[model samples]
Target: MAHLDTLDDEVPDISPYVTPISPTNRFYRIDTALTVPQVDPESWRLRITGLVDNPYELTYQDIRSMRLADYVITLSCVSNQVGGRLVGNAIWTGVPLYELLQRAGVQRGAQQIVGRSVDDFTAGFPTTLAYDGRNAILAIGMNNEPLPTRHGFPARIVVAGLYGYVSAVKWLEEIRLTTWDGFDGYWVPRGWSKQGPMKTQSRIDLPSHGSRVNSGETIPLAGIAWAPTRGIERVEVRIGNEDWTPCRLGQAAGNESWVQWHRDWTPSGGGRQQIQVRATDGSGHTQSGRTVPPRPNGAEGWHTISVDVR
Candidate 1:
C-alpha cells in the first residue's frame, strides 16, 4: 500500500503576472516523456474492471446507447501559471460517470478509481468524487462538435470540482477501481497534488496591454472567473490600489464553466493603470490575497494587468 503522506508538502505562493491578451498564442511545449497514442473509435473499448463485481468492457456503440447530457465546463491545466492561457471553456456532451458506475456496482474496499487515457497518461481520483452526481461525464463531444484530437478526441473523463490533472482525463480508455495503494498518476509522480478543486480567481481582459485607449473615457473592462460546481458568487474589480467594487457578471454559460464579468471604468488622467480582479465562490470562499504557484494544486489569488491610456 502506498501512503498518501509521502506526497510532497511544498506549496509555492502564486506568482502574479500581467495577464497577456494572447495567453494561448504560445506553443505548449509537450514533455517528450509523455506518449500520445493515436485513437480509432472502431477499435476502442472502455474497460471497467478491478474491484467491481461485474467487470464490463464497453464498446463505442454501447457508450453511444447511454443518454447524453450537455453542459459547459472550464478546464485549467495545473501547469498554467496565474493568469496563464492553459485554460479554456467549452460545452461538453456525454453520459454521466455516476450512472455508469451505478450500473457496474462498485465493490467494497475500492477507495480510488484509476483512469487511463489512450495517451498512456493516468490519474487516480477518489471513488467518492468519481460517483458524485455533478456533471462527471464520459464525454465524447465538446462545443457541440466531436472532441478534437488535441482535446481528448474519442472519449474523455470530465469531473467537476477538481483540476484538469485528475478531472479531465483525455483520450480515456480504462477505469480500474483500486485501493489507493501503490497508485500514482503521471503528474503525481512529478510532484502534483492527487486531489484538486479549482480556487476562486478572476482575470482582466479588456484594454489589452500595449493597446491605446482614449484618456478619461469610460471603457468596459471584461474577463471571466470560475469555481467549478460551486458557481462564481461575485467578482470585484480594483484600479491602482482603489477600493474593490462589484462587477456585473453575465449569465453563466454553465455550472462548470467560467462566468463572464464586465465593469465600466473611466481612466483618471492615466499614463498607465493597473487593473485587478478577484472573485468569491458560492460557498463564500474568497480569492486569496496571497499568491501561489500553479502546481500540486490549482493556482491562487487575483489576476491583474496594466494598460496605457494615451
Candidate 2:
C-alpha cells in the first residue's frame, strides 16, 4: 500500500469541502507517484518547448516573476466516485497559462498542451484552453501558502472544469505543445478518455448515511455542488419519496468554484428516510441519473444517503 493513504492508499482522501476555501491540509490529493518527488526550487526549471517559436526555460523565480493572478477553482480527481471525497477547492496564485504560451509564441499547428511532471506523469489538453477564455494557470501558491510539497511544491498546472487527470499536473517541469496525435497521457493508455470533463454533481454531507437523528426537529442538511466552468445553476434535495426541493445556496465564489447549499426539512413521519441530491449546471443540464464508474472518465449519478429518523 502507498505510505500516505491516511487509511489505505494515498490515491483517495476525504476532501475538505468547506465553502469559500478549504483548509490547505484537509485538501484532497490524487496523483500517480508512488514516492513524492523532492525538487530543489533553485535549480528547478520549467521548459516551454515543442511547436513554439520561442522555446525557452523558466527558472522557479522566472515563473513566479510574472504578474500572477488568484483563481478560486475546484479540482476533482477522475477516479472520484459519485459522492466520493477526492475533490477540493482552493485559491491558487499563478500566471495565466496563455501569458506563458503567448511568450512562447505558440505555433499554428499546436493543438495539444501537455504538462509533464518531474515524476514523468503527463496530462494533455487542448492548447486553446489557455488563450480561449478558459481558466488555466501554472499555480505556485495554494490558499495563500507556498504550494505544499504534498500538493506540488513549486508549481502545478490547473485548468478549471476538467478532471485532474486531464488538467492538473503537479510538480510540473515542462509544458510541451504538440498536436492531438503527438502523445497520449498515462491514463489514456489505461483506458480512460483523453478528455475528462467533470460531470455536474452534488453530495449531502450532513445527516450522513446510517446516522440517527431526531424525527420531530428540523433536519438541517447541507453539502456542496460543483459544475466548474459551466457553474452550478442550483441544487435540489429529495427526502423519502418527496419531490425534489430547491436548496438554499451559499454565496457563489465564481463560475469555476463549488457552491455551498443547505436545506432544512421537517419530516412528518419518522423512519428510515432516504435522501438524494442532484445539481443543475449553468447550461441548464441536470446531473444524470445513470450510475457510472470513474474509470473511463468521471462518475455520474445522484448522491444518495440514508439516515435513521427516530
**Per-candidate RMSD, Å:** 9.3, 6.3
Position 169, candidate 2: lDDT = 94
Q: Cα deviation in Å at residue 166, candidate 1?
A: 1.5
Cα error, candidate 1, residue 96 (Å): 0.8
Tens-place lDDT per residue, model 1, 204-294, is: 6665656667887877777777788888999999888899999877666556767767778888775877888889998898888788888
Question: How accurate locally, in lDDT, is each candidate?
Answer: 0.72, 0.85
Please provide, for model 2 over 107-191, each residue's C-alpha lDDT reduced to its tens digit, 9 standing for 90 to 100.
Answer: 9989999999999999999987887776899999998878999899899999998999987999999999999998998799989
Q: Candidate 1: deviation at residue 272, Å?
A: 2.2
Model 2 clashing residue pairs (backbone)? 5-9
- Lowest summed lDDT window (length 10), candidate 1: 1-10
lDDT agreement of model 1 with the native: 0.72
Model 2, total clashes: 1
